[model samples]
Target: MDLAERIESLKAGLLGAIAVGITFTFTVFIHQTLTVSNNWVLPAFPSSFEDLSAWVREAVAFGSGFLFGVTYRYIIRQGENPHLKSGAVMAFGLVRGLAQIESISDRFTSQPWLAFVLLGESAIVFAVAAASIDLAIAWRWIKPAS
Candidate 1:
């Protein structure tokens, strides 16, 4: 579908999504800043950007926005109502924050037990993101797309 058509049903609601745009912009900005800073003359990630597990963690954190957006879009499609701009933004923000927590948790390494613990912690974060999106819609803050 054309970009316009693909998002057509939800465009207004997508635009209504308010925080969706800002969240993505900030995510990209942070990713770029981290990438540039990590590769700066000082170079904290001596393992190279490719090998830095931190980058992987960062990637998951950033991807949270996509999952949140999917939920937000679905919310708009199902709720049949629009939401307070700030509420929608904040809702997505929460989802992103949860993702950040999960990403950070997954960054740790050392023991098998620690890995399992971190995995569960990160999964919880992702679950929160998904749940928030579901709740944001269930709460009727975002209307279903027409």
Candidate 2:
């Protein structure tokens, strides 16, 4: 890719990541509230939201969205329609890949239900992010991959 194309890709990725991060934050907030209020689902958070450690973790999670955006752009060739099927497929692959990691597997061994919920949430968030990015590209709000 040319320098200009690379720059545009970076811009798109950043914008997409910001959009996804905002959406993810809201989703997590709502999920947490409902889970806590209902007492039916117990999510295994590493720390309390108010804790600095939690903030650090959240930052990392948000940053990962940028990588996801970049990857999505790379996967969908230029001029190709970034349709729902592509987005869903990418999200599923990402979620499944992460779930296969030993660290993730070990972390959820004691709380398989929480793992399932988290995995589902991750898939939904990624799928939405992917679709939103594609919409932005289609609308000319962001530059498409080249």
> Highest lDDT among the candidates is held by which one?
2
**Tens-digit per-residue lDDT, 52-82, candidate 2:** 7557656755676777777776677545665
lDDT of 1 by residue, 1-146 (tens): 45543554343333323333343334345555766778522121122345556455445554554555554554555444545433544555555454444445544443335344334433443444444455655676533444
What's the lDDT for all of these models? 0.45, 0.63
Q: Score candidate 1 by TM-score against the native.
A: 0.35
Query: How close is every model to the real structure, measured as TM-score?
Result: 0.35, 0.73
The 10-residue segment with the lowest total lDDT in model 1: 40-49
* Pairs in steric clash, model 1: 76-143, 76-144, 76-145, 77-144, 77-145, 78-144, 79-144, 80-143, 80-144, 81-143
